[model samples]
Target: MGKTTRDRLLQTLASAFELPEDVVLDLTRITITGNTQFLMENHRGILAYDPEKISLRTDQGETVITGRNLKIDSLFASEIMITGSINGIQFIRSRG
Candidate 1:
């Protein structure tokens, strides 16, 4: 089946189960804590990384995080955690 059809089915299932689309569809979830820590789930991969900037690809868009002394504390297949003096977060919406 096509992606659209699969997504539609997942949407319906999410609605019927009263579950968030993020849970059912494996959407990206980002959380920030105290401007010092960042966590993301279901992330595709890191596009770029540096001490001052980090970019990641997700299902919805590109996530760009800027900060000072940025460090990746943990990384997994679909989750990542970064810690530093976070200054900004930007989202570039996906065309597809």
Candidate 2:
């Protein structure tokens, strides 16, 4: 298949799995709507990296996470590592 076709196919698959395009392309970081944050390293998805204050938004409510020094390690493609204390996590969905 062509590069464009292949890219589209990969994007479709990634979206279906709630993954971002950067993750598939082995990018550095993938931020969705500035709400959902994803750190890419290898080929895995690690959620809740922030420890001091991690927030996530959904259509219903939000999640707050609290801990300590929040950080992501070995982030390359779809793999990420979170360190420090998990302060809180929040989830909020945007209405359009």
For each candidate, the alpha-carbon lDDT, in order, equals 0.94, 0.47
How far does residue 24 in candidate 1 sit from its true spot (Å)?
0.5
Worst 10 residues of 2 by lDDT: 30-39
Report the Cα lDDT for residue 14, model 1: 95
Error of 1 at 49 (Å): 0.3
User: Candidate 2 has what TM-score?
Assistant: 0.31
- Assess candidate 1 and give its TM-score to the true structure: 0.87
RMSD to truth, every model: 1.7, 10.4
Q: Pick the candidate with the highest lDDT.
A: 1
Deviating ranges (above 4 Å) for candidate 2: 1-51, 54-65
lDDT of 2 at 62: 39
Q: Model 1, range 1-96, lDDT digits (tens) per residue?
A: 498799999999999999998989988888899999999999999999999999999987899999999999999999999999999999999887
